[model samples]
Target: MNEQSPLIPTLPQGTPPEDLVPIGAPGGLDAAINPLGAELWFLRDRDGGHLLWNGNPDIWSGRAPILFPIVGRLRDDSYRHDGHVYRLPRHGFARHARFTPGAHDDHHALFRLEDNAETRAAYPFAFALTISYAITGNTLTIGAEVANRGDTPMPFSFGFHPALRWPLPQGGLRAAHHILFDRPEAPDIARLDSNGLLARSEPSPLEGQELRLRDALFEQDALIFPEVNSHAFTYTSPGGPAIRLQTENLPDLGIWTKPDADFICIEPWQGHADADDFSGDIFQKPGVIVLPPGEVWKASMSLTHERSA
Candidate 1:
């Protein structure tokens, strides 16, 4: 394959924003990135509340900022807090809000979001969320920072969802891909129900293989992996460079692909979907984080593409 710049349409200042971009051609890297060619990056705005892509916070990408997915969806966009229920949009309001652009050079850019009246009404907290994207050689580094600005404590979760091109030789319903991890023990897989809620699946070995993606596999929605050992997961084609994702503090990983769809979502999360019998307390939610008054919490992960030996 030729080493060509990813295709993305240029959005001059003041143009209507678009989340998807073409990649993999000349002068393409500067265009907004989409999954049609290779990989696309997504990020959230200053408020960290909007979805930015599909009006859902968990999935986002666009032309100017270089789309990358972030956050997860809360059921009905509602969660219980101290016995009071607060309603938020699908992935909260972070992705839709305009972000303050961070200083950048030629290869990288940074964006930030915060919580205010609009955010407080839905989630009731003041906070800051900063996301940075940097590219060096063939690797991309992504980082996120969250700070609590409320007088009282706050509870929340965070994560990343990236879709990479399946560089296999053939494309069909029976196409297979191999996934390998850096850890010894396989992470616990959480099976999603018909309603998209997650439940624990039977523990299985992390043996490597090229498994076909069939329609039957997605009947359960997504494969959620908890108890991961801050390691990396790699996917490779028969004769292509490996696509690798690494995490440090994140403890959860989700692997999902739409049935008959052209792409797969490799999601790294700090939190997860609501449980089947959830009581609604935000802190009690699985993988939820509790921040003390004026306290701050941070979590991040990175992705890289490289040739296999």
Candidate 2:
């Protein structure tokens, strides 16, 4: 993969406006990413079919919101850093932040965010976060790059939250859809308490190789697998359209959907929310990444659409 990024179209200084970066190859995947939070607004497959959730308000308002600085809810919605407590909202502020749109060369586009007064007040770290989306053939790859630009170390968590159609654009009923793992083994999922923090690891209700989708299955909220045994999985419907999700360098996975909602999210995460009983430093938080000064961290998730019968 080429690391060189194409220059994104820019707006004049002091211009009041909304800018969106569009990137994709000519004959395959095409997508639009919102600079605000660097969120993906659209994804078009080779067949010109949209595979991402359409963000209907009746089901869920969110599209694909990135989880940065944190993946899930924090204990008390706050964390201790250097003996001082910093308050961060659930899923962190990256989803709400405005990112600087970088260059795009048709096949890929980049967006960047840096620590400022607001971020430092909550994160207290000097860092730069860059996100890039690339399309190759029938695959769309999303990468998150975190750099500790300051002289001190930086600690944080990040993840991708892409909500796909429950029945899928390929067509099927929710109950008729199922997820098949590349590995035969089923991994345990940590239950969430009333507070939404991880309760304990329990044996998954999933069957040997496939987990059928059911509305009641998400009544308790997201199904989080802290110890994900499979790096890849194929999401299939009754017939035709399907998508294969591949997570590289990301270890955790979360499958979530609201009760009776039209979309379900397959999340690839680097870290998860803190445990309910735990109240510790952000650096020591479970699944947190501590990058030394001048160091960079990277993780990616790739989605491939399969329409072959």
Candidate 3:
């Protein structure tokens, strides 16, 4: 296969000392982003109640982290490509790498992360990733775009890992909250092995379109739906406010939280961890997206909060 020497694009890099970019809408929704990981560290509802998990280090300190290149763990924290093996930590490097902040305003902000020597060493390819956040009314919309600058096809996965407040600050008992999908869901789902690799298909705990939230459901770790049919779901409790999340171009979803943790992560994923029995090329990974050279792949999700009456 022939390859082209494309001109690599450059942008300002994010420096240390971890500063936060604050954005808010006239409607009262507000957010704070840390460019170091392009992570949304805070989000408040229109009524001034927090809707996102506060990264309390004692528990799980991630608010909303972007997952890319690989969604979950590999068989051995590594992958094979072009006869060479490369290593990537869980959820890939995007969550830990710096992203250069770009255009911004009161309610919108854009940040970019491009492949560098560090990235190429781990996953040999030229690519650019941009993440944008915007708030309008009571909704926060997040957009991610990945462009393959190499002449050959680039195989990768992307996902959004957002940990919203468990009881959602709108006033509800933790055990009272549940998830309502847009459609009835299947009874079976995928699970992970003790090693965190994709294990096997098992019976799902969901009952029709609803999944009542509880700590016991997570005793074995994250519940993954590799074949989710709904593009939207609502997180709420009876008579409480709700957070409705909508996804675009994301086919899989995962729900997880540390038992009794104050937050629950609703993840919309384009790909997942490697199956325990499969260890082939990166392109062969399940749910991976192959983007042709010079092409861009995009995915987005929106979160709308409904205030309690």
RMSD of each: 7.7, 5.7, 8.4
lDDT tens per residue, model 1, 1-309: 122321211222233234332122122122222222112333221122111122122332322121112234566657877777888654456545666665655656666777767777777777887776665554566677778887887777776666554433132222556567676655346676665566557654355432344455665677677866636877655554456778767787777665654445667777777776676677778787777888766666665554445
lDDT of 1: 0.55
For all candidates, the clash counts are 28, 5, 0
Model 1 root mean square deviation, Cα atoms: 7.7
lDDT of 2 by residue, 165-246 (tens): 7777666666788898777665677778778888787778689878888987788888887758889988988775788999
Steric clash pairs (candidate 3): none
lDDT of each: 0.55, 0.83, 0.88
Candidate 3 to native Cα RMSD, angstroms: 8.4
- For model 1, give the 10-residue run with minimal summed lDDT: 44-53
Better of 2 and 3 by lDDT: 3
- Candidate 3 structure quality by residue, lDDT tens digits, 1-309: 012201111212212133677788776688878898899877877666778777777777788999988999999999999999999999999999999999998889999999999999998999999999998988899999999999999999999999999888866799999998998778899999998899888888888889999999899999999879999999998889999999999999999999999899999999999889888999888889999999999999999988876
- What TM-score would each prediction reach against the true structure? 0.74, 0.91, 0.93
Ranking by TM-score: 3, 2, 1
